[model samples]
Target: MDVLYSLLDVHIQQLNPIIQDKTFTNTLNFILTTSTDDIVSITTPILDRFCINILPTIDHNIKSLILESKSMERILLAADYPSLTKLKLFNFKDNIVSYYFTDESSFRRIFREQITDLILIYDKNNDITVQREYRNGIHEYIMKFFHNLKYLSINGPSSHLILDDSSPTTCFSSILTKLCVYVYCFQDCLTLLDGRLKQLTTFIVEIDHSEPSSIAHNMNNLPNLTTFSIEYRCNTTEFDIQVLPLLRRMSNLEELTLIIYNENRTRLVDGTYIHNQILLHLQRLYKFNFYIRTCTDLNNVTYSLSSDNIQQTFTNIGYRHVKCILYNITRMVICHAFSLPFISNHLEYLGNTFPSIVFTRVTKLLVFDILPFEHEFFIRLARFFPFLKDLSVMNLHPQLCKSDSVNYDHNQQYPVIEYPYLDSLHLEDSYIDYVEQFINETKIRLPRLKILEVDYRKLNTITKQFTRDVTRLNCAKVHRLIMEKQVVFPKTFYVYFPLLESASSYSYYFKK
Candidate 1:
């Protein structure tokens, strides 16, 4: 009903003035004035019509306006938006930016006092000179006119621009609470924040170089800062030296996210000593996220274990609290040497060097990015993690399902391995037959399992068949099945399994 009314509102606005009635105008006015409503987008033609024909009567009713750069000036000048307080500008060009900041511009007269939240977006072009100019002009424009501006976002090429014009003595009226900008302008932004935005509580910055030490030094100035994020791209050695020490000073930080890139994969294999040192200082920290990426040679690489004597190399060190998902052989060796507790790797890798001390405490596990092996390999892997609750496996071979030569009934004679606490399972890019075989043959029932997510884009024609088979299974414990693709079940199937239908109290649908 709301969608229908909104559609009617759009069509009525498009009608000719002679055809527009009082009821239509009233409905349009109600939509414009409603503070709870969001006017998401407005095209050039609609904006022009509103400014020329309708705005004169309902100018004071509008609370927010989102305009494109092309029509921003014309729209602002059409009427005096007395109640407007929020404005967002898109595709803002260099010339238009400069024009609006000038003293003579009519836009400054109407919106300068009321607009507290402002957003400016520019095209990300390869031309460095144009970007620099736009950044300088836009920064100057904001500082001059929008003295009361509280929330501001300047995205794109402005990150590379250095604000040489801003001085330490300049005072700004706005007390910015949140800021997102690039590393190049970080120092200048701090200079601006020194006296102006002293109350800022959140800061998100992107670092593209190896100067994390300098960034850390600047962060001390933001004493009131509670949330800090650093998206760093550099080598692992540099991160260890420059980035780790920086974490020690952020005592007031409540949440932290570090996205680190490693050019040298060998450096991370040493263990979590550096990470542990950093974690020790964050006493007030409640949320901590660490993401690492390393360069890999995709063309010529073999994941096969070289020796059976690998288990003799591990020494039980005190680095048991660290948990990680290792990608290759070097990382696996590194984890073993450090005695890291949790691991997510291939069945082949685990079979060759299964460490008892490390596997006993692992609660989360993922077997990903490996060649397919038999179902027996998975059964062996599950035995290692006694407290395992979450499991995600990808790319298993389909032969495990069709291997009738080996009797699973004999395998079932062994004690059934049940993960009592395992509530969530995710399988991606695997054969449907293998999945069915694992569920049926293993006879492993997760009584506490509530969520099951599967990705079957690899199975095209038999996707629905797989869905049907899963729904018909004895999965009484499962409540929600989240699939990558949508599935439709037959009405008779739902009718026959009325208890399953009652158990799942909601309709199954794709989550966008």
Candidate 2:
């Protein structure tokens, strides 16, 4: 007979090490299935020594024995375990319609003392919440036993669980400090009394679109909180920013992540500016992340420069100076208002009008974008931000012409115009023909060239011949040829592709 000692979940059978050694007992979580008899037969004495988890007598009965015994069959049980800490039950397909607390009292009597962190996952089949009278009796039994429990997780809809005024009295008083719930409505938050949440440190709420105010109000209530996340994507309505003053009250807050959908109105009111100013008042907040659908929401904001200038209004401020500036220029629409100028143009203005802006503060600038094929504005863009260490360019658009110039090469005979101290260059695009001349020219000039990523666009016989000629030159330190729609390598056109780990369109090849 094999004596097995292990911590096991039957779902991940491949990764689990089979119990071959019996020298030491192990902490175990044995998930009971139809093959449990075989498991018990293989490892009995080893399991008795270790911390093992199995369905209690009543839970085991529901798993086996399909016949519905409705004549009020009672079972007797007894257990004594000291090392148990975490317990979870997912009795979705158990068909627990007829099992009452009085009948399953033997199983409850054993579990009520040992279990600490309990997670119960309820689904359609064994949904106790649907049976009101039976669920209430079961909850009463559970609350009485697991009084010392700290972490509690209840999954499923709120409509399933019946909560009256006395529900909190039975369960939510002395023990629980961390609570995570998936249900909606302010009713869940309002129901949790202040006494129960006084010692609470972390609370995560996954609320639906219908209850934004409830999420906001709960954020206000948790004064002892350190981390908070609210996901309200489906909700069409905007959360009232009036809650900012209340949120400012959370003095101990360290991290906050707010993900909100786009609002219908573009023009933000002056009151919104009032709330934006409140962020500076937060003395403890070191890290902040705001992800809104529109940049138009950032319009209008005031800040304090010093005690001397209390009347001064400032729109944006970065606490610590950032060395690199990343420009993401996709899906941005501006119809000629008092909008900011193009980044390269803005940099030029800051350098000329405010000469102190360049060569002193920022060290590097990385621009990765697909400029419109029709416009040749990149020549003008290359002039600004003269002190860049790493320059990365990605052309996302499909079509491009060879004559379109984004000049980086400066001739020795020309006027003294300092080139950017560009140490690394990363280029990726489908239009390699358009950038062929630029690549050939810059490869010889850029002495500090180290890394490159090139994705070739789909082409016919003529274009493939052109690509082979470029490949044979073998100019780049890391050159990769990506033939989209197929993997057709050119004959004897060997080029070193140190970085060609995999291609993007892999599955498309198999389909063809």
Using TM-score as the measure, the top candidate is 1
lDDT of 2 at 372: 38
Residue runs of model 2 more than 4 Å from their true location after superposition: 1-79, 91-103, 122-145, 156-171, 190-196, 211-221, 234-237, 241-246, 262-282, 285-512
lDDT for model 2: 0.36
Clashing pairs in 1: none
Query: What's the true lDDT of residue 30 in model 2?
Result: 37
Model 1, global lDDT = 0.50
Which 10 consecutive residues of model 2 have the lowest summed lDDT? Answer: 345-354
lDDT (10s digit) by residue, model 2, range 1-512: 12332334346655233432222122323333332111111134443432233323113222111111221122122223333455554442223323432335444433455456656544323333354443432333444556566666655432223333444354454566665555343334344523445655555544443443333223334567665444333222234443244346556767654433333325322213423654555667765544232222223212312211211222334322212221223432111111112112111111101112334222333333445332233333234445443444445554443332223233222222223344434344325533443344332233333333344442222134444333322234333233334456554223333334443332211000
- TM-scores of all predicted structures: 0.48, 0.39
Q: How many collisions between residues are there in candidate 2? A: 0
Q: Model 1 — which ten-residue stretch has the worst lDDT?
A: 29-38
